[model samples]
Structure formats: C-alpha cells, structure tokens
Target: MKLYIKYMVSLRCKMLVKEELTKLGLGYASLNLGMVETMGEITHEKRVQLKNNLLKSGLELLDDKKSILIEKIKNVVVEMIHHTDEIPKINYSGYLSEKLGYDYTYLSNTFSEVKGITIQHYIIKHKIERVKELLLYDELNLTEIAYKLHYSSSAHLSNQFKKVTGLTPSYFKKLKEKRTQNLENL
Candidate 1:
C-alpha cells in the first residue's frame, strides 16, 4: 500500500516518517518525499494510528484524491529542486505532466486553486530557496549555482534572485558571512 503525506518536504520529515512507521510496527518497503510504500496493506486502524502519529510532527496523511495529487506534484518538484544532483533540462510543466500522468492545465489549475499560487511561481520560489541554501553552503560560485539549477546564465539567476528576494546573490552571501562572523564573535 502506498501512502501520501502532506507538508513532508525535507529530509528531516522523511526521517520522522520512517521513525513513526517503525514505531507503529508497519513495515515499509521504501520511503520517498511525501510518500511511502508499505510491505503489505495497512489495516484501517493502523492507518488511523499512523495518520495521528504523523500529525504530531506536522505531517498529514492524505486520503483525499485532490490532496494526494497535490502532494505528488509538490514531492516531484521538491525532489527535483532540493534533492537531485542535477535538475533536468526540460521545462517543468511538461516534466510534471509526464511524471504525474496528468494534463498540465489540470495540474496547474488544481495547484493554483489549492495553493493560491501558480505552479510556475511555486517553482520559482523553491528555486530561490535552494539558491539561498547553496549560497549559505559557501561551496558553489554563483555561476555554478545558476548552472546547477538550470538557469540560462548567472545574470538570469541574479535577476530572478533579486526580483524574488529584494537582494542580489552577492549581497545575500555577504549577509550570511557577516552573520556568521557575528555568531563566531559571540
């Protein structure tokens, strides 16, 4: 049996889900972002228990079709952006459609209706967050970060970063450095 979870976007969330599954004595074959495949079918009582346990950690077990579909879309996007080593070169809507086996229009409309943000905007916001994370890591230069995130150029990445964050990427990195120095001094 496959279970879908909501608000499960990070590795921490995945670990929590795994812990809950083990605690509940449910054998899971595998876990993915916002999803798990159980070794066998889960009893309704255990399902309810798992749902309640997950809720304590701010994760929701999704039984509703619309909620499950939205979670699937979010999981796919999050996996592509934050977890993958290299993002695919194709356009995201087409990629989402292919991955989910749904019409792009349908997915877009559902996401906007539920999230109050267009899917493209959602993608942009997540990309910017990932950029922030990479900047904080101090490992990749801006040009390489742009390339890794599939931006056409560093200039394009800077433009979007500034547009979304109201700060340039260099300034953002500088802010991180200044804050780290302050923390070290303290």
Candidate 2:
C-alpha cells in the first residue's frame, strides 16, 4: 500500500511519519516525502485512523488519484530543493519526466490546471524559498547562494528575488534578523 500525504516536505516530516507508523504498529517498507509504502493493503479502519492522526499534525491523506499525482509532483520538487545536497545539472523538465514516468507537457499542464500556476513558476517559487533559507543561515554569500540555486549570476538572482519579493536580497537578508515571510506567502 502507498499512502500519499500533504505537507510532508521536510526530513523531520519523514521522521514523524515513520514514528507514527511505528506507534500504530504498522510496518512500512519505506517512507519518503509525501508518501509511505507498506507491504500489504491497509484496512479501511486503519486508513481512517492514519488520516485522522496525520490531520492532527497538519498533514492530509490523499485518496484521489489526481490529488496523489499532484502531491507526488510537489514531493519530488520539494525533496530535490530542500533535502538534496545538490541540484542536477540536467534540464528540470527532462528530469521530472524521467522521475515521474510521464510526459513533461502532460504533467506541466495538469499541474498548472490544478494549481493555477505553471510548473516552472512553482519551481522558481521553491528555489526562491530555498534562497531565502540559505540567506537566513548566514553561511553563504549572495554569489554562492545564486550558484547553488543555479541562477545565472548574482545580478539575475537579485532581479528575480526582487521581482518576486519586492526587495533586494541584501535587504531581505537584513530583514531576516527581524521576521521572515511564510514560504507560501512568497
């Protein structure tokens, strides 16, 4: 059985899902961002209980196939940006197509139809969020951040950052000492 979960974007979320399954005496083959896999089918009662528990912790159980597919797309992108040590050198469309086993155009169209935003826009949004995270950590300079996130140059990064955030990266870094906006808000 495979379970699709919402908001399971981070490593802590994976740990939490694993712990919850353990507490429920459920044996999972693996747990990853937005999903858990088990060897056997889940009972209706067990599914309900799992859904309720996940909901309590700000997660959602996706039963619909379309919803699951969308969540899978989100999970792949989020994991690549947030959890992985490095971004792939290949094109994102090709990478996503190979990873998801779907035509890039189909997936992008579905995502845009359901999410009301283009897949590329979503990637940019997530990358910007990652940039914000790196900036807040204060371990890397602007050029390094730009390079890590695959921006062409510091100037390009700054332009996009300002376009999306209404402020320069330097200004954003200074404001990070005060408060940061939620990723969804950006």
Candidate 3:
C-alpha cells in the first residue's frame, strides 16, 4: 500500500514517518518525501490510526486520489527546488510534465483546483523561501543565488523575491535575523 502525506517536506519528516510505521509494526518498502510505500496492504483500522498519528505531528495522510496526485506534484516541485543541488535548464512546465507523466495543462489545472493557487505561484513561493535560506546562511551572493535557483538573472530573482517577500534580497540579507515560516504555512 502507498500513502501520500501532506507537510512531509524534509528528511526529518521521512524519518518521522518511518518511525511511526515501525511503532505500528508496519514494514515499509520505501519512505520518500510526501509518500510511503509499504510491503503489504494496511487495514482500515491501521489507516485510521496512522492518519491520526500523523495528524498529531502536523501531517495529514492523503486519501483522495486527486489529493494524492496534487501532493505528488507539490513534492516534486519542493524536492527540485529545496533538495537538489542544481536546477534544470528546461522550462518548469515541460520538466514537471515529463517527471509526472501527465500533460502540463492537466497537471496545472488540477493543481490549481486542489491547491487554490497556480503551480507556478507555488514554485515562486518556494524559490523565494530558498533564497531567504541562502541569504540567511550568507553563503552566496545575489548573482550566485540567482544562478543556483535557475533565474534568468539576478534582477529577475530580486524582483520576484521582493514581490513575494516585500523586501529585496540585499535588504533581506542585511536583516541577518531568522524569519522562518513553516512549510505548511507556505
């Protein structure tokens, strides 16, 4: 059985899911961001227990097929933006379509319908969040950050960052104070 989860966005989240599965005496074949694949089918009671446990930790086990697909799309975008070392050169629509094996239009429409926001908007929001992280670490300059995030140029990155954050990258970096938001909030 496979389970899709919301707010399972980090390595720590994967670990938590694995731990919970172990506690439930369930063996999982794999636990990736936003999902878990088990070796055997789970009963309704187990599913209910798992859902309640996950909810306690600020995660939700997705049951609807459409919701699962939407979570998959979100996971892909989150992983590509926050976990990968390099960004791809291809357009996001094409890349996502190829990755998910669905038409870009269908994916976009479904994502928007379920998420109440465009996928592109979600990507932009995540990119801005990443930029904030990079700036906080003070590891890269604007130009380097732009390149790392696959922006056309530093100006483009700055513009989007400002638009979403209400502060330019330089100003944000200068603040030098942490202002982290929960992934679920984003």
Please give, for residues 68-148, the per-residue lDDT of candidate 3 as tens digits: 889899999999999998777899999999988999999999999988999999999999999999988888999999999
User: What are the TM-scores, per candidate, against the unseen true structure?
Assistant: 0.95, 0.91, 0.92
Per residue, candidate 1 scores C-alpha lDDT tens digits across 1-186 of 999999999889999999999999999999989999999999999999999999998999998899999999999999999899978778999999999999999999999999899999999999999999999998999999999999999999999999999999999999999998999998
- Candidate 2's residue-wise lDDT over 1-186, tens digit each? 888998898878888888778878899988888989987898898889888988888889898887888998998898778888788889889889989999999999999989999889899899999999999899999999999988899999999999998999999897876565554466
Better of 2 and 3 by lDDT: 3
Off by over 4 Å in 2: 177-186
Tell me the deviation in Å of residue 24 in model 3.
Answer: 0.8
User: What is the TM-score ranking, best to worst?
Assistant: 1, 3, 2
- What clash count goes with each model? 0, 0, 0
Shift of residue 75 alpha carbon in model 2, Å:
0.9
Comparing 2 and 3 on TM-score, the stronger one: 3
Clashing pairs in 2: none
Span of 10 residues, lowest total lDDT, candidate 3? 176-185
Top-scoring candidate (TM-score): 1
